[model samples]
Target: MEILVCVKRVPDNEESEIEVNADGSDIQRDDLVCSTNEWDNYAVEEAIELVDEHGGNVTVVTVGDDESEEVLRRGMAMGANNGLLLMDDAFECSDGKGIATILKAAVEKGNYDLIMTGAQSDTGAGQVGGMLAAMLDYPYASLVNSVEVIDDKKLKVGREIEGGNQEMNEIDLPCVLSIQTGINEPRYVTIRGIRKVSSVEIPIQVASDLDISGDSVGAASARVKKIDYFVPELGAGAEMLEGATEEIVEKLIEMLKAKGGLK
Candidate 1:
């Protein structure tokens, strides 16, 4: 089986404050620390493990500027066979749909038996995998926590559902799976592996190379647009209730009733 894993380089939200740029088109990224999307790391690890078990190759792909290569190299260090960087000035300002379109174009250029991606990006726009699957007209499952290869052309997957339930199903090969976090612990990239992949050239693909018009990507092709961005004003602080447990409960009920929150 040949697996293709799509990864993204995203800002480390935990370590940086997100401020909208003056243009209102995107966030201010100049001071942000960028790293591979956390969930994508799990996808990469799962792909590598699958290949390790089934005897196949795993390729990692990403779409972004030069910095995006770092995420691909990280994947290679974690045992991916090769990396593909879809870099083009035309790809800037692309929305999720535009990205999925480009990824579909890239996937078409390869012979992949399985495709995996994070259930959602750091941006929380969980759209890429499903959109890419739709574009490719392939079977897809989202929020997948486990994947079992049933045969050369079939796979049984466990999808995470509400209330911690898992829905298992069998799907044919050449399908896309949106992996969820906690599926597996991602391995760290060692210094030696990093140096090794650094010398391995990563091929770049432009929009035209994928048979896509430059104008048909980026903001021009985006299905959604950001109208505004601003930090939400901090709301009122919580009020602490002081009394016995029963008294506190009674006071809470009274407050709720006064606010018309209860019968």
Candidate 2:
């Protein structure tokens, strides 16, 4: 059971404010603190648990610049066997499909039985896992909250659906699963574990190394383009309508008639 878990570095914006950059297409990230994507931590923990139970190696992968290595190291501290960093300037402007292209190339290079990723990123794109699965032509499931390995080549998974429903299915191995949060509690990275893995060298893979064309990734290959980006303005304050129900209704009707809202 060689599991490949894909993680990402995201801004810790829950405790901080977000500011749009000058280009109006991205966030102002210079002063922001970065950490593992919250959902990806659950994915990492699930992978680690699977490996611990089945006796296998867990390799955590991330695609980003130099700063991305921090998340990989954190995964190692959480008990991943190794780490792979997919870094290149060409990846900077990649849209969902472009990213999937690069990831598929790298995943094909490895002998992995199962691939896992977060159900959605903090950026809220939520498209990579499905795109990657399509690119790999692998069986795919999203919003997965539970996994049970049936055999060396099969698995039974439980997915969360709307209305608090759980959909259960059995799928073949060599598949991709987008893990949702609450599947497992992620273990904290201890200082000792971090120190131990500090000296472990993480291999960086570039687009060329993965045999991915420069034109196949980045902004040029992107299927979607950001025309503009801006935060929504705060709307007008609420108005209070206090009195008895009949009086309130009468006042509302009068106001609506006065405003030409009613015939």
Candidate 3:
């Protein structure tokens, strides 16, 4: 059961103040503290645990600049057997689909029994896992919270549905799963663990190495883009009813009556 887990480096919201850049295109990255995406850590941990029980190897992959190597190293420190970095100048400003395209190429190059990705990125977009599964023509499940081995060809995955219910389904092998946090507590990567994997060689794959064409990715190819990033102005309809709980409830009733929101 060889697993490929996709990890990402993201801003540490707790460690840095996230602000929109002056151009309103993206977040202010310079001086921002960054680390492995929290959800990706859980994904990598899940893969390692699965491999531990089922007998296989876990490999972590990420697509970013050289600095992004840190996240791969962290994943390796957490017990992944190998780390892979996909970097290329042409991969800059890639949208979700572009990232998925790059991941698809890497997946094609590996004989993985399972593929895992974080349920969502800090950017709040959970599109890549589904898109990558679609591009690879593999079955995919998102928000997966539990995994059980049914056989070499099948796996029982549990997902948390609405109303806090758990839904279980049997998915075929060679599938992709977007792992949800709380699936398990990720093991801590101690200094000793980091040092142990410090000298391990992590391979790098570029756009050419992955057979990804420049025109198909990067800023020029992005169909969806952030042209601006600004907070929406407060609407006139919004009201703050300040008082004791009872008074506030009465005030809310009056406002609702005035607005025809309540019968």
- Name the candidate that leads on TM-score: 3
Q: Judged by lDDT against the true structure, how good is candidate 3?
A: 0.94
TM-score of each: 0.87, 0.88, 0.90
The top-ranked prediction according to lDDT is: 3
Check candidate 1 and list the clashing pairs. Answer: none
Candidate 3 matches the true fold with a TM-score of 0.90
Residue pairs clashing in model 3 are: none
Task: Summarize candidate 2's per-residue lDDT along 1-263 as a digit string, tens digits.
Answer: 99999999988888668899988878887789888999899999999999999989999999899989999999999999999999998888899899888889889999999999999987698999999999999999999999999999999999999999999999998999999999988998999989989999999999889998899999898979888888877567646678999999998999889889996
lDDT of 1: 0.92
Q: Candidate 3: which stretches are off by over 4 Å?
A: 237-263
* Collision count for each candidate, in order: 0, 0, 0
Mark the regions of model 1 whose C-alpha exceeds 4 Å error after superposition. 22-25, 234-263
Error of 1 at 23 (Å): 5.8
What local distance difference test score does each model get?
Answer: 0.92, 0.92, 0.94
- Model 3 lDDT per residue over 94-177, tens place: 999999999999999999999999999998999999999999999999999999999999999999898999999999989999
